[model samples]
Structure formats: C-alpha cells, structure tokens
Target: MAHLRDQPAGVDGITIDWDAPIRVSDGTVLRADVFRPTEPGDYPVILAMGPYGKGLHLADGYPANWRRMHEAYPEVAHGSTGRYQNWEMADPEKWVPDGYVCVRVDSRGSGRSPGFLDVLTALQARDLYECIEWAGQQEWSNGKVGLLGISYFAANQWQVAALRPPHLAAICVWEGFADHYREGARHGGIACEFVKGAQARQMFTVQYGMGSRGPTDRNTGRPVAGDVDLDDDVLRQNRRDLYAELLARPVNGEFYQERSADLSRIEVPLLSAGNWGGMGLHTRGNVEGFLAAGSELKWLEMHGDTHFNPFYNDRGLGLQKQFFGTFLKGEQNGWLDRPPVELLVRHPGERFEPRFEQEWPIARTEWTEFHLCPETMELRTSPGASGTLSYQPEHEDLRFRLPPAGHDREFTGPAAAKLRISSATADADLFLSLRLYDPQGTEVTFIGSNDPKVPIALGWLRASHRRLDTDRSEPYRPVHSHDSIELLVPGEPVDVDIEIWPTSIVVPAGYVLELGIGGRDYSNQGTEIENAMYPTTGVGPFIHTDPEDRPAEIFGGAVTLHFGPDVTSYLLLPAIPAP
Candidate 1:
C-alpha cells in the first residue's frame, strides 16, 4: 500500500507516493518512491533502481563525499531544497519541474523492500526489467522510461538494457563498469580489497531490516531500513557473502559471467560518460561499453574530475538534459547532429578543454612505441644493448624515464606495455604506473575517482594469468584471459602484455614522462585529503594487499628484467596529433 501526500502550496510543487508496492514476477513486493509533477499530466519517467537505500539522504549516508562535492561545486545545491538528494541518484526537485517523473526504487533486499540480498546478478536485472514495465503502465507516465545514475546505479543499466525492455528509451551510464571479473572484484587476476571495504561500509550499513540501528529519514521521520529490526545472525543469513564468493572463484567462471553485462545485446540509445581520472574501475567500462554496444545511436563523453563531481555539475547536468530531452520527449534538440564522441582534453594545472570527435581512439592516433633500455634506465626509440636488472619484489621498484619533450605532446586513449621478465619463484605480480613530472622535477598528480592524488595511468597483472585473448587484442589495448594460470619456470624469461586503462594528458616542452614497475601498489609522500574515505594515495582503495592471494613464498621473490636483442620490452602509447 502506498501513502500519498501533497506538498504545501508554497513548497516545491511536487507530489510524493511513499512506500509504493511494485510486485515482480515471483510475487516479491519491492518498494519505490515516485516523485511526479503536481499539475496532474503525463510525463516521461527517469527510473533508478539500486541497493542503496532510497530514503538514506546523501549527507547522512556518505557524509565525506557529500561535504566534498558540495564544497567543490556549490551549484549542486543551488536550485533545490536538497532534501531528496540520495547517493548517486537524480534529485527529484530538479527533475520534477523539468517535465520528468523521478522514480527511485530500493532493490530486492535493501531499504524498505524485503527479500534475499544478492547484488549484481541476473535476478536483480530481472527485477529491474519488471520495474520498468510497471513504471510504463502508470497512469501519470507517458509510456517512456529512461535510465540514469552513477556507479552502482549506472553499472546495472548495462545488464537490464540487454533484456530489451520495451519501455526503456535511453540510458546515461555515468562512470560505471560493465565487466565484473576485470573491473569489479579483480584486476589482472589479482584479488582486490575494494569489494570487501565497499560491502561493509556502504551496503551492509543500510541493508533491509536494520530498523532502529539505521538512520532516520529526515523528511518522513521514519527508519530508512524498515519498520522491523532483525537479529545480526538473521541478517547474515539473508544476504550473500560477496567477498567470500569472489575469493572462492578466482577465475572468470560461471560466477562472474552472470554478473557481467553482455554489451552486444544492448540496443538502446546510450551516452557513456567516463572520467579520465577513474583509471582503475570506471574508465575501461565506459570506453568498452561505447565501442561494443550494438546500439546504432550511441555517444561517448570523457571528462577529468572527481567521480561524483562531473555527474552533478552544471556541465554534466546540461548534457544529460540535452540527451534525455531529445530521446524521451521527442524534441528536435539537435543532439543527433553532434559528433558521437566528446573528450575533455587535459592540460597542465588541472585544466580541460572540450572537443568533439567522430570516433574513439581518435581515427588519427599515432601508435608510438618507446623501447625499454635497462642498461641506461631510459625509454628510447631504439633498443639498447643487452643488460639485466634485478630487484626485490616486496621492497623495491624499477623506474625508466623518457627524455624531456622537445615540444608539447598529447597522449590520449588506451595504452599497453610488453615486458620480458623472469622470477626466482613460481609466480609474481606486476604493478605499473605512468607518471608525469614538471620542469622542476616535481610529480604532477590529478584528482582521481576516490582519491585527491593519482598518476597519469595504472595497470596490474599476476604473471601467471598472462595469456591474451588474441581475437580481441588490439595494438594499443591488450585483453587478458583469466580462465587459467601458467606458473613461470625459475630463471626462465617470458613475454607478457599488460593493459593500461585509458587516459588523456598534455605534456609541455620541459615535462618528463616516467614508467614505474613494481610488485606492490604505487604510493608517494602526499598528505591525505580530509574528506576522502580512504588514504588519498595513488591507487585509492583499489588495492591488492591480500596475503593469501599473493603468498610471500611465491610472489615476494627476486624479480629480474632481461633486456636484449632477442627479448625487447617496450611501451605502446596512443599519441594524438595537433589538429
């Protein structure tokens, strides 16, 4: 049963239906909150379904992110009361007045809804598809629905859209990853600790049945989790142990296949907005989604900023309205006349200039290779004399630097590194970092997705999972197959290809580019930001520090780099020419 309420005459002029029951195929009743215009007319719908509690206000649920976002861009809260602002979802106050109904639903077992909690599975996608159909049949709906949100909300859109829901018109995937195996739980076949931290701090806190333990919704003065509280043991039994499952399944098997999206099956209009700073998690998905999706009408937009900033800022909001207005409202807004790709060209001092393009990897990209010379510790155009270098995997890092640029140069798009190496142990893990230094030799870092300081690009790979999917491999991007592992033979050198996520940066005449390779995560002597949830180091929270995943006996051994005429290692870059 829904409890309908009309706003006061002077208030925002929007009506709300709280705790609306949306029955799915299995007779499970999900809960949603619908915000519609008070004028009583049919309008297009913008629906968002996720595990985050719909009633948990942004300030209450994620205080650090909320404060930092507002402080950086005050315009985010300029036009509305900020009461309906939830984590990563659209604001009802902004959408209702623009002739669009905003629908925020609590996924199966979160918030006011009750069921088994399983995040990012086929079951969740089916529930979303049913919710879309339900929204299309509403009396106040104009029979058109659009999907929009950030991170988790955006990631699921790729899965549900593949089902080809009749009412889903368009989707704007803002900083979302599509592959669960590569971008979600593991990177380069090494277990990442991000999922464990996120599950504990973000999901379990607001899970359904928290009752008195959960925060109260400021607007309704009721518990955000639900009306009844369950014991700790019962709550544990209701939800799947996501971290445990990831550790148990180390390869790309049936477990990961069910969570990853089938990009070829998605045929709806798509606008994938990715961030240059989101190297580890968000960048790869957006670029891959834009290229692999079967949609005839698709566009890609890349920007440089904090993950949450660009989605709510004026520039981001404008692009969203222009896209949704043309698709859902049947308006001739000239959106289709624009190019299919938009890039925010990055320059020194955190500046970005927007440019439109015809395709990704910019059709005119010059694929340049910088050969690694171990003898001189430099990246040169030609291979150097045979030399060998060894370092302790657990304690030391090896760096190779390129000479100062003679003129301004721009490197934009995907990158790859091919290395020939040997290990004293059976296996080893490799971490790569591309860094920039100014004329004074000071490192230049950018604001990453979750951290305040980040490198130009980062990549990781466990030596054993070095097999490539040759069919999908490109000159600039190397795709890895994590189905099985092939341990290395002691003192034997093998060639391995590593894929560095997409990035964009302009280097001035005196600036230098350096590549760092090590067996551990990259870090520098920088102060952590006050509002960052994790230490604002180079990699943020996407770290691979699990001892069980990288045992001391196998991974923490002497690693050797062999350079010779027969075994030449090099870095592949996508250098864009000045137009």
Candidate 2:
C-alpha cells in the first residue's frame, strides 16, 4: 500500500494504512483507510463508516463540491496537505495533524470490500458495530472510539449507536436523518426523487458491478476494488434495488424500522449537530435525536449552511472536537458546562450569529399561530374572509403573510401547520414553507442542504400520513405515526397537522413572515448553481413526482383550503422572545 503525508521536513506527518482489514462478526472483510500521526502512540479513534468509497478523493469524485468548498472557505487549505480529503467523510488532512486517528471504512461490497451491498440496512449497522469493536482492539487505538462525519457517514452513527457497541464512546451525528421513511426516502408518504438521484451519482460510481472494475486510488497505487468483477447475474444479486425496495414499503413499517434508529436505545454521549438549511433530509433527525435520545450527557448544535461546510470548518469542528475530546480522550474540557442547545440564528445575506440556549423551543417561545385568510391572502392573528382556495399539483399555490411591518423577532425551533383542507381526488400531497420577506414584498430565501435558493423551512405530508400519536405529538412539533395510511374521503374537509421541520430565522422589523402552501417545491426565479453530483436547483433532487408514488389519477387533482370558525387553519411558529 502507498502512504501519503509526505513533503516538507520538520512538519508532523501522517501514517496512512491503505486497505486495512476490518472483519465483521459474520466474517465479511470490509476495507478502510487509516490516517494517524506518524509518531503515534495509541490515539483515540474517530471513525466514519458508510458506503462512500474511502479511496476516492473529494476533488476527483465530487469536483463541484471541491470547487465550491475551497472558494467559500479558503482557510480549509491552511497548515496541511490536501491529499487526504475524502467526500463526506472526516478529512485526514485536518484530523491527522490534530493527533486524532481518523478511519474511513468502505462498507461491504463497496470500494475494496467484498460482499453484498445494501445500504442503511440492519446488516450494515451490525457490520458497523463490529468494526467499532475491532477498532477499539487495534494496537494503535486507545480503546475509545467516536463516530463523526456528514450525511451518510453521520446517518449511520444513529443506527450503530443503537446497537450499543461497547467501544462506541461518543457520536457527533452531523446533519443526519433518524427516520428512514419519513425524513429520508419518503416524506409524508410521497417518494423523494433524491433517493434515486443520489444513489446513481454517488453509489453507482463505486458499486461492484459486472463487467466493470472500479478506479484505482492514486495515493495507494492499488485498484480500489482489486479487480473485483463477477458475472452480471452475480453482481445484480449482490447489489440492492434501492429505489424499488423503498417503493415497496410505501409506509413506515418493518422495512423502515429496520433502518431507523430507536433514539431511546442510543445511550452514548451524544453531540447531534444540525444544519438549519438542511430541511429536506438532515434537519429533522438532529432535532428529534437530541430530544429523544436516552443519553444523559447530550448536546445539540444547529448551524447554517450548505450541508458540508460546517463539518470541516472552524465552527463545526470546534464543537465536534470538544464533544469527542471529553468523552473519547477523557479530557475534562469545559464541554459539559456549555449550554445544551447551541443555535446559529440565521439572518439575511447568509448571516448566522451564534446563540446559546438551555433548551430547544427556547423556554420563552410564544407558540403563535397565523390564521389563513383566503380573500386578502393575509396571515392574520384573527380569522378574516372565510373562503376556500383551489390548488392544482405543481400548477398553482396560495400564499399568506403577516402585515407589511412588524416587530423584529426571532422564530426558532420547530413549526407546524393545521390545515382545514379537502382534495378533489382521494389523496393530495401537502408542501408547506415558512418564508421571510422584505418590506417591499421581495421573497427572502436561504441556502438549504443541496439547494441554493431554498425557503426558510419546508414540510411535506401526504394526506394519508396525517395521523398523529398523542403521546409523542407536541404543539409546534407534531409527530406523525406513519404506521398506516388514513385516506381522505372524497370532498370531505379534514384537519391535517403538517409538522414543519425545525428552523431559525431572525426577522428584521418592518420585514414580514409568510407561509406558502404549494402542490410542488417552491421554485426560485433566480439562477441555479451547477454541482457535479446534483442539479443545483431550489429543491435539489428531492422532487416528489414519482409516477408510482404520485400516480396521475391520485395526485393530479384540485385541493381546497377552508377557513372559518369550525374549520380553523393556522401556522404554528415558535416565536422566541428577544432577550
């Protein structure tokens, strides 16, 4: 194996162990790239486990991301060689110099590993737990292990942590989803196209396919998959029909439960980091995980951004190191005394100022609701003209907003909406957005996970997935059962509670808060940024018009919003009082 971390003298270097073997309980051998201080004693291990190829460099695999990242944060190149950076995983270029051993493992049937490839399944989580145990027993390990990474790497932390591997000391789930069906593949029972798009652009590149051999790692001078190729039938059998399988499990049940984490079972020291703009996939998980995890020493940190920025940047790394340092290194850093919730309150022009709070839905929140008045198209404290507005899927939408001027206030924590609505057809897909506007009526949007012009926050619900469990449901954050579908009877008015994901935006005085109920994603009139992996539009690949999920007959219909005394509809916002 070839080693990196070579160059100038007198500079501390890293020892790279390429294609390191990690044996799971079932005898499957996964591959990993280990990076640690060349002059290392035993170091606490920071492991990132996922299907992402460990051998691929961020620059080569995700060129658009590399360009965007370096352009935005040039400091990321400070004090290190950029040769060891991988996509969505811990950068050895940064962590290795800081005396931490960073391990990036390629799960079974990925990269150089040989076995079946099924992502986010219980089997993968089991393999992850075993790998953690193996890492702890390694000669270069200090018997303490922490999980840290973004997206896929972060998502799996919740899964394996639930397994309670003895070696798993701490987890920093940065921008991850807890529920597979709800927050991931399907939202409110409607299929998300991102699952299909992301898998093709990300996973298909390195998947062990027949008649093909994967790329070679430039640093290691070895084939990424070691010439692993099988018959077409065999390769087909090894990989999963990811999208089709998700379609089969239309609702959250055994299929989703197996992939989802039981937050109560995750009792390890936790630092669930969130991205305020990651409404589509990452926001809800971090919010819910922080609230539901059984861990006593848990903290939540919400930041602003494009999903990957914070992880490698000073803001995110600082919080992660503090959390892992205390639990993994046993260093008594002042991490414990820090507030339970650390939020970066968002403002216009991508401004995010840090705000520390003791709890989410900050104790001083005014649970305010803005009722919908159809005629004036206004969001009023008191109901106005009682009428119904028609909605055509992806063709038309309605908007409601506060007065032209108001107090400068901060809306933090989760939000929800109660809609008195009916569909011309038996089913309708509900898309809600909490937005901001300048006094001049110009729409204000924020940068979301993959979308550059995303709204403040968004929530989706299929009319059928509207059943809420009283035990778990809260006023501002309503939790849907999603266990069964409750179809709407034709032409009947139903009160549906749509749980808008957590968001934080500081409204300037004279500015306004607006809510948009749409049949489709909120489109941006602005230009789109091009990314190597995704089409950089307002919604990224998280589109909702899968023919199987939203058939022409069911989703193509007229929907109506009713407003009156008996059928009250409103937007529940967490108005945090200014301190």
Q: lDDT per model, in order? A: 0.89, 0.82
The 10-residue segment with the lowest total lDDT in model 1 = 1-10
lDDT score, candidate 1, position 293: 96
Instruction: Kindly provide the TM-score of model 2 when superposed on the true structure, using C-alpha atoms.
Output: 0.96
Residue 418, candidate 1: Cα error in Å is 0.3
The residue pairs in collision within model 1 are none
Identify the leading candidate in terms of TM-score: 1
Q: In candidate 2, what are the lDDT values of residues 381-426, reduced to their tens digit?
A: 8877777888787787888888754567888889999998899888
Angstrom error of the Cα, residue 326, model 1: value is 0.8
Each candidate's number of clashing pairs is: 0, 0
Q: Of the candidates shown, which would achieve the greatest lDDT relative to the real structure?
A: 1
TM-score of each: 0.98, 0.96
lDDT by residue for model 1 over 351-426, one digit each (tens)? Answer: 9989999999899999999999987899888998798888887798999998897899899999999999899999
